[model samples]
Target chain A: SQTIHQWPATLVQPVGSPLSLECTVEGTSNPNLYWYRQAAGRGLQLLFYSIGIDQISSEVPQNLSASRPQDRQFILSSKKLLLSDSGFYLCAWGPSGGNYEQYFGPGTRLTVT
Target chain B: AQSVTQLDSHVSVSEGTPVLLRCNYSSSYSPSLFWYVQHPNKGLQLLLKYTSAATLVKGINGFEAEFKKSETSFHLTKPSAHMSDAAEYFCVVSVGGPYNTDKLIFGTGTRLQVFP
Candidate 1:
């Protein structure tokens, strides 16, 4: 069975500070990785998706960016965070190709104060 | 392009009553649809998916959804609501094909409230 892990389950960052959130999947190789954000009382917004190492497609223009440094490792980063950046960030992975059913990680609650 | 619409932003049902969360979709082609659930402070869990294989799909936790192409709807239902079923439900549609860049378009979401 495959498992996804995300860390710093909760984070508190000052506005204008940098941000970094990591996600990794075990027991799967070359999987499609995605980054999504959900504001309080709202639905998820897709931020970035990576098909392979170094191949990332961003769904929105914002203060955040994503990278696939390794086949199973994905990182969401920001040079400077904004108050609007505060939200619950979710990381997900799916089988290669057009499989839309994805496995999601526990998520990171980022509070930018 | 593919999109989904969750009819109700919030629904309240009494325990032991039937549950219905309506969803409608729009797609240029035959698209895949899915329903996901998220408990408070928890990650989203896949409840069910419609891949054209089955018009009626059964998912975990006694949940089921039926796909109606004519109505362009995929509505979720359960015979009886449980307290544990109170959560946020999302309807999603796939926009890509096997040869395209795959991504999902999500509905605003419906919050299910099961009350005893």
Candidate 2:
């Protein structure tokens, strides 16, 4: 069984401060990773997805960037956070066999004040 | 390009009643569709998926969705609603093949409220 772990379930950051959210998958190696954001009660918006260690495709342009340092490790970062950047950030993963169904992590709720 | 539309933003039903949530999609090519459920403050859980294999797909928690190509709709239904079924549901579409690099488009989502 594969499990995804996301850190800092809830975060409070000052506007203009930096941001970093990490996600790691256990029991699954070399899996595809994704980043999504949901604005309270709204639909999820895809932010970025990585196929490999350095192959990343961004769906939306904003204050966030993603990196796949290791096969099972993905990180979402921002140099300067904005008020609009506050939302529920979710990390998801899929297997290399081309399964469309992705398992998601608990998510990080960021409040930019 | 593939896209999905959730017909209802919210649906309320009494416990033990039937549940219905509608979703429609637009795709240039043969698209793969999926349904995901999210509990409050929880991550998304895959309900089911359609890859043209079966017109009807059964998912977890006694939920099922039927795919209608002519209507371009994939509507979810449950025989009986449980209070635990209250959550937000998202309709997703994938443009590529079953095993390829595909982008997923999510609908606005339908929130379900089940009451006793």
TM-score of chain B of each: 0.95, 0.94
Error of 2 at A41 (Å): 3.0
- For each candidate, what's the DockQ? 0.70, 0.63
Q: lDDT tens string, model 2, A1-113?
A: 99999988999999999999999999988888889999976888889888889878888888899999899999999999999999999999988757777889999999999
Runs in model 2 lying further than 4 Å from the true structure: B97-99
Instruction: Give interface RMSD (Å), model 2.
Output: 2.0
User: Evaluated with lDDT, which candidate comes out highest?
Assistant: 1
lDDT of 2 at A20: 94
Model 1 residue A48 distance off true place after TM-score fit, in angstroms: 0.7
Which residue pairs collide in model 2, if any? none
lDDT of 2 by residue, B1-116 (tens): 67899999999999999999999999886678999999988899999999889899999999999999999999999999999999999999975533355567899999999999
